[model samples]
Target: MKVICILCDEAFTPSKFQARKIMKHPHKIQICETCHDRITTKVNMQRTAKP
Candidate 1:
């Protein structure tokens, strides 16, 4: 199934398991892997920088 990322607005195909989870939970926001990794890296950097 094709899913669109909320952040980048890019469309991507996720695994069947993920698609099912998203379908089951309509309230969950979907984000592409790229955006997810970027956000994770930024948060990690900020956390480590804070002492």
Candidate 2:
């Protein structure tokens, strides 16, 4: 099924396997790989940064 990234608004299609998993959470917004990676990096940086 087709999905759009909530963060970057990018459109993409998920595999049948992924689609099933995603459908399990109908209320949750989907995020693309690019945005997911970017967010993950930012979070990791924050966690590792010196206070």
Candidate 3:
């Protein structure tokens, strides 16, 4: 199934299993792996930043 990333708006097709997982959370925002990874990296960096 096709889904657009809520963060970057990039459109792509997810595997059947992924589609089912996303659908299971009807109210959760959907973000592509790229955005997810980027956000995670940024957050981790901030957490480890010098004060």
Candidate 4:
């Protein structure tokens, strides 16, 4: 099924199981892999940075 990334607004097709899970859970937000990876990297950097 086709899903739009909430962060980047890019359209992508996820696997059938993922699509169904997203559909079933209204609170879940869909994000493309690229955006997910970007956010993950940023978060990891923040975690490792000394304050």
Positional deviation of residue 47's Cα in model 4 after best superposition, in angstroms: 0.5
- Candidate 2 lDDT (Cα, 0 to 1): 0.84
lDDT (10s digit) by residue, model 1, range 1-51: 899999999999988888899889979999999999999999999999996
Off by over 4 Å in 3: 15-17
Clash pairs, candidate 2, are: none
For each candidate in turn, give its C-alpha RMSD to the true structure in angstroms.
Answer: 0.9, 1.6, 1.9, 1.6
* Residue runs of model 1 more than 4 Å from their true location after superposition: none
Among all windows of 10 consecutive residues in model 3, the one with the lowest summed lDDT is 25-34
Please provide, for model 3 over 1-51, each residue's C-alpha lDDT reduced to its tens digit, 9 standing for 90 to 100. 778899899997777877898789767677888898999999999999958
Q: What is each predicted model's overall lDDT from 0 to 1?
A: 0.92, 0.84, 0.85, 0.88
User: Which candidate, 1 or 2, would have the higher lDDT against the true structure?
Assistant: 1
Best model number under TM-score: 1
State each candidate's clash count.
0, 0, 0, 0
- State in Å the error of residue 39, model 4: 0.2
Task: Choose the strongest candidate by lDDT.
Answer: 1
Can you write out model 2's per-residue Cα lDDT over 1-41, one digit (the tens) per residue? 78998877889887787699798987878787788889999
> Which residue pairs collide, candidate 4?
none
Candidate 2 contains a number of clashing pairs equal to 0
Q: Candidate 4's C-alpha lDDT?
A: 0.88
After superposing all C-alphas onto the true structure, candidate 4 shows an RMSD in angstroms of 1.6
Off-target runs (Cα >4 Å) in candidate 2 are none
